[model samples]
Structures are given as structure tokens and as C-alpha cells.
Target: MGFADELFDLTGKVVLVTGGSKGLGREMAFGAARCGADIVIASRNHDACAEVAREIEAETGRKAMPYSVHIGRWDQLPGLVDAVYERFGRLDVLINNAGMSPLYDSLESVSEKLFDSVMNLNMKGPFRLSVLVGERMAAAGGGSIVNVSSTGSIRPNAGILPYAMAKSALNTMTEGLAKAYGPTVRVNTLMSGPFDTSAHDWEPESLAEGVRPHALQRIGTPSEIIGSVLYLISDASSYTTMATLRVDGGIP
Candidate 1:
């Protein structure tokens, strides 16, 4: 392999990405496959995950396994971890990219159930999955994990307060896991900005206003996240861990 390619090569690595059916997860799965990794794509929707798995297999000639999972359920996570190891025998990379940010009219209208939903999905699930997968990775020699966070974690707004709190906790988890699993496994966070993707539900005028504080003056595109994700998961970042890389267009 060429020197640059050698530095980032992921040949024979098995990557598991949560929420891999679409958006950042889908793109990261494809990117890893392109780098010669076998991938497992998981989401709540079986059909969606299967479709992306099929597409990645067709395009990159890489093995892609798809599983439907609800990250909100703690019991479901162990099986998800088991399924990856059972199918691929090893998992070298994990992208905890699944998340939710439901809208409520106001803070007063927020139900306890709604609050739990956000925390369970965004924070609790990731912690449980990471611990299980990270132990395996550390035992097997080494691995990398990239937890996807949000700019909202640092800049909470009324509409997504619960989501922000969950993401903030996720960031803290990233640091704790890095320390706990290090010397063999690395853990990091990708604090992302607003993006123009299938996940977006913003009007053009609203999006334009939202971009004003960002130095880039535009929403990120899904493909834009691939480089950082690849760097973190591959040998390119062999010495880096417990870091939060900002892909947020420098929002003020």
C-alpha cells in the first residue's frame, strides 16, 4: 500500500455502526467499507438497515451485516454486540451514532417518559454497548470507538433540552471509557453541527438563520463527517484518545 493509504488502511477490520441505515451512520458505514472493513449496520428499522447493507455490499464489494435494534432497550444491546462478533469474529471499530431529538411545545409539557426516552436512547444505550464492545476490543488486542455528540450539547436550546443533556452525558462517557479501556482501545467523541441530510427537518429560511453564527455559514453535509470518523477509527489516530473533535463549522 502507498504510505498514506497504509497509515489509514482498515483492511480486515470489522466495524459496527448504530443507526447505520441513514445520515451520518450510513455515510460512516460506507466510508469504512471503502477502506476495506467489513461492517455491521444496525437501526430500529430492519428494512432500512438491510437496504443500506445491500447498497454497501454492492458498491464496495465488502461484507455488510444489518440488524434491527432499539438502542433505548438495554437488553437489546448485548445481542447487538453478540451478533457482530458472531458474524465477523472480531469488531475493530464502533460508531455510536444513533440519537434522537424530539420536539415538545415547552419544558412544562415534557413528560417523564419523554425525558427517559431521550436519556435511554442517547446515553444509556451507548454506555452499555460501549462497555461490552470495548471489553472485547481490549481483550482482543485493540479497537477504536467514536461517539457522535451534538453541538446542542454545548449550546442547548429550548426545543432540544433533553437531547442536549443526553449528549452532554455522552461526551463525559467518552472520556471515562477512554481512560478505562486505554492502552488497547481508544474512545472519542465527534461533536457535530447542523447538517443538511435526510435527518434534517428545517425550512430554508430557518436553516439560513441558524447558520449565521457559524464561520462556515452553512450546514455540514453528511460526507463532510467521513474524514474525521475515518481518522479516529483507523491507525491514523493511533495516539489519540479521550478527545472531542468538532465538525461543527465553528459555531460561535
Candidate 2:
């Protein structure tokens, strides 16, 4: 194979993507499968995950396993990890892409339940999964872990304060894990900007205002994320680790 083609190839790799049922997670799962990785699609919806898994197998001719579990629930993660290893034999990449940022009226109205839910999914779960998986990856040679974070972590506002806090913690965890699992397993953060996904209710006016601060002056497309995902997961980023690669539209 050509150098560029070989660099991005994932012939025998196994990738597990959380929240793989829809949105950016779905796109990343497809992208990885297309490049020759067997995929594990984990999400809360069993049918939805199965549907995506089927499509991935049909289109890419790669093995795709659908797993259902709530990422926020810490107790459920061990089973998910076991299922992947049992089916795939090994996991070469993990994309912690499942996250939620619920809307609330005001800072005063944000309940402890809401805050804890945000932290559990966005921070706690990812950490537990990484510890479980990263240790194995380190022992079995090496692997890549991409923690999907948001620009809001650094650019926090009252609107997304709790979610932003969680993401910020995720960012810090990525760096720490990189050191803990090195020099074999790679750990990094994929800091994203606003994208036009089902996750957002992007009205025209809101969309326009959202992208105003970006240098690209536009919201990113789901497909546009594939390049960054591929780069981080594949050997293309061999020299990269313990870094936060921003896929944002140059939000400054």
C-alpha cells in the first residue's frame, strides 16, 4: 500500500465508540469501519445501535457489534468492556464520544441531579472506561483513546456551566492517562466546536450567532469530523500523544 493509504489503514484494528447509535458517534463508527476496523457500537438504545452496526457491516464489510448500556452508569461499564474483548479479542482504539448537556432555565434552577448526571456521563464514566481499557491496551502492546471534549470546557458560560466543568475535567484526565499509560497506549482529547448534528436544535438565527465567533464562520458538518477522528485513531498520529487536538472552527 501507498504510504498515505497505509498510514490511515486500520486493517485488523478493533474500535469501540460510546454513544455510537447516532450523531457524531455514528459518523465516527462508519468512518473507522470504512478504513477496515471492526467496530463496537455502544449506546443506550439497543435497536438503534444494532441498526447502525448492521449498516456498517453491510456497507464496509467489517464486523460491527452493537452493545447497549447507559454510559452514565458506572456499574454497567465493566460488562461493556468484557463484551468487546470477548467478541473482538482485542481493542485497538476507544472513542469516548457519548456526552449530554441538558438545557436549564437558570443557574439557580440547576438541580444536584442535573449536575451529577452531567458529570457522571461526561467525566466519571469515561474515566472508568479508560482505566479498564487503557490498562489492557498498555499490557497488550498499545492503543489509542480519544476523549471527545467540547470547546465550552475552556470557553465556559452560564448557559453550559455544569457541562463545561465536566468536559474540562475530561480534558485533564486525557493528559493524566497519557502519562499513566505511556509509552505504549496513546491518550488524547478531541476538543470539538459546534457541529450541525441531531444533538443540537440549530435554528437559523441561533446557528448564525453560534458560528459568528469561529474563524471559519460556520458550524462543522458531521462528516467533517472523520478526518480528525481517523488521524487520532490511526498511525497517522504516531508522534502525537497527551495532546488536545481541536476540531473546532478556530473558536478564539
lDDT of 2 by residue, 1-252 (tens): 888789999999999999998999999999999899999999999999999999999999999999999999999999999999999899999999999999999999999999999999999999999999999999999999999999999999999999999999999999999999999999999999988899888889877897897899998999999999999999999999999989989999
Per-candidate TM-score against the hidden true structure: 0.98, 0.99
Please report how far candidate 1 places residue 156 from its true position, in Å. 0.9
Candidate 1 wrong stretches, greater than 4 Å: none
- Judged by lDDT, which candidate is best? 2
Model 2, stretches more than 4 Å misplaced? none
